[model samples]
Target: MSIAIKGGNIFQNSRPFFDEKMKFPSLEELTIINLRGIAELWHLANVEDEFPAFPNSENPGDSDALFNNKVALPAIKHIKMSLVDGLQKIWGSHLDVRSFNELESLDIKFVEKATKAFSLDAIQRIRNLKELNLQQFQLTGQFIERVGFYNDEVENSVLLPQLRNLKLDSFPQLKRIPWRELTLQNLRCLQISEIHDLTYLFPASICKRLVNLEALRVYDCHKMKEIVREELGDANTVEVKVVFPHLNFLRLSNLPAFQSLGSDNVILEFPSIKEVDFDKFQNPILWDLLQKLKPVKELQLGRCESLFELHDLKGRSSTMLPRLRNLTLSYMDNLQRIPWMIFPIKNLRYLKISYIHGLKFLFTASMCSEGFAQLEEIHIQDCKDIEQMLAQESIEDTSNNAAPITVVLPRVKIIKLYYLRSLRSFSSENYEALEFPSLEEVEIKEYDKEYFDLNTVIKKRCTTRLCYAR
Candidate 1:
């Protein structure tokens, strides 16, 4: 049977919702769109053996509600509640998953009431659950600290064995999620948003246990300080590397207090990640940890006010970002320069740098011929101090008195330059010829002074797109 209560006054009496002769043995899906009394559903699903276990069930007259409760819904699978304002909670502890044998998905929203103490123990027995989502359920404290919240009583237990996806959003009072305590073997994706009090997202134990998690996203968590908490170690023990084994997509945004994700005490590894995004600020360790990541394809660091430069990628190191294709550096006010050799991405396809005021140059002429072999596109905008694309002293032969230099970017096809007040030439010397045989389109807009001649450098087949302030 399927039930969807659109908008109607709930029956006020304590009679059965369905006729006894209707034979509605189990439900496949149930949706509650708005407020309606649902105490009867709980009363019907409750069992006398379950009620007797709760001391509060012995109340003076409340037991009368369940005296004839033998409605069996042993096969209910999907349930979603959009706004059940009249129904405080479905089942606190009076009902457990002992009745929801085939339940697979549960989603609830706007569970707000002033007097009820809701416990989530009702869902633990649902061993077949694959997805669980709770939104705007302003729970302030723990109801069952161990089984539902921390440890389950089921011995040799792998809690929520089939659960694959979990999401928790808008719980302002939640300080932590018991990822370390949950022995879930199949959880694959997790998203937590608008939880203002969580100080850290992962414990060291979770990094060791959650080998199947693929994507993790956390946003609008105002008080979060770190993505992973370093496990406290014994004074004299060895710390092995902790790997997220399968995590491929990671996004951390709008977290002002974020610091190191791993501890100074343990080595961390992400061998399978393909893309990483930081929408706002980040800590120094995030940049430091990138050294250990596997080959990533796309990376974007946007509006990161705390980041000054790509300082860690410099110097001689065995680190390689071999699979990087698209790289964007945006709104970073303090980034100083881009040294192409610092990046080992020889086949890099696209690069963009925008609104970075402190940036001065993209590369030195001497390194340009040795780097960016298979590049296709380049874009630079709103960088006021960028005087040249390549540094001239990098290739000028001072010992030979003077000589003409030709800089080659063989596979370059598209380039855009905008709002650069200080650019004088592609190279420091105004006479050097910059060659782009495969150039297709070029855009130069709103520069305070004309620096490079489009006709002289690009082939006649290339088209220049232009827009000037005047």
Candidate 2:
């Protein structure tokens, strides 16, 4: 059920745990938590077979001998092997997960076998596996493509059918997501993050085959150039449709190669999509298509240096999000103003506007309250030129009684004007009138304390927890 591998001398002590010939227990249930990193010198005893004729001074003994010792893990519901030295090959003839017929979950990481493959045969062994996580392992060119010496023959391995949830991080060598090798018809949530060299993920033709896929997230992969590069004359028209049709939530970050979602060729689809996060990246037609998201409930746009207008959120905009509940705009170095006079949707409950240095006026008119009065929360931070939270004359009902405007976030709860040498004060007049009757906590980092003492600014009735990291 659980396993831990630690300490510096595990290799030396592993000999005594077993008999004269290593042997393991055969029990109805077994747990092997290794803490054997205690050895003074780390030696690969397993390498002896390959370099057997070496001088007598260097031999550590047979690597497989340590593991070959009979250790019975009968009816083992869990099997964890840490600091397993003989793993110069992951799918060796002696290694198998299927042998643990009762195994339900598997977590394997830091396997030193750099060139070893976790073969389809190895994965097929875990027929009952419900959850599998492989983190920080040195996988070879067997599963993914474009590794230094990859061969297509090894890339065509079969998929893992029983695996439902998968998280991949920090596999820099993997260039392509092995789409055809793995069957993910049952997968519900997929998170692929920090895979630096991964370029193309989804297959052009098999998007619809992943029928059960609900959430697809790709983040922090720097070298990834494109998702489906049809505009480059590469992708087929039909493939993009089948893949993203059923997706409900999608997040793309730092993917510079991903230029557009759909062509004018057809309505940029993703009909079932409910939320999208485009964080800190620039793309071609990204704003043009983002403007077309009609049914999206939450849209977050941040750090797009090329974005200057809401041309995407304009026009009769049949695509304007009518149901959007939360809209977050932050760190858009190029954004100058809010594009539309009609603030967010009447149903919009939370509006977070932060760190857009280029913004001078959020809206053209002051006291522009027609579409914003229904909003429960409005947060504006770090846009020095925007002097007021809400335009002074925008709402006739400043009376706190009308329909609980922006009730969710009535005031700025956390304000960090860190290193903002120009900021003289949070507000110049009637700062006390700023409403956040329910505000409870605040965190300020790297800010000058000479201008205002936080203890004096907080409301008497509300409990505020302030974390100041100066």
The candidate maximizing lDDT is 1
Writing each residue's lDDT as its tens digit, candidate 1 over 138-172 gives 76555233434533343444557788999888877
In model 1, the worst 10-residue window by lDDT is: 53-62
Tens digits of per-residue lDDT for model 2 on 1-470? 33333443334423333223222334333333343322111122332343212122222333332232133333555544445433444333333322455656555555543444454445445565556665665555555222332356435544466667777765666666666667777777787877877666654455656777778788887766545433334344443343456778878877655555533233345678888788876544565556656678888878877655445544554446777888888887667666553335556776778888766544322233344444555556676555433332333544554332221223333433333323333323331233445454554444446764665445535443334534
Q: Per-candidate TM vs. native?
A: 0.71, 0.67
TM-score of 2: 0.67
RMSD of 1: 6.5
Tell me the lDDT of model 2 at 108: 54
Pairs with steric clashes in candidate 1: 146-151
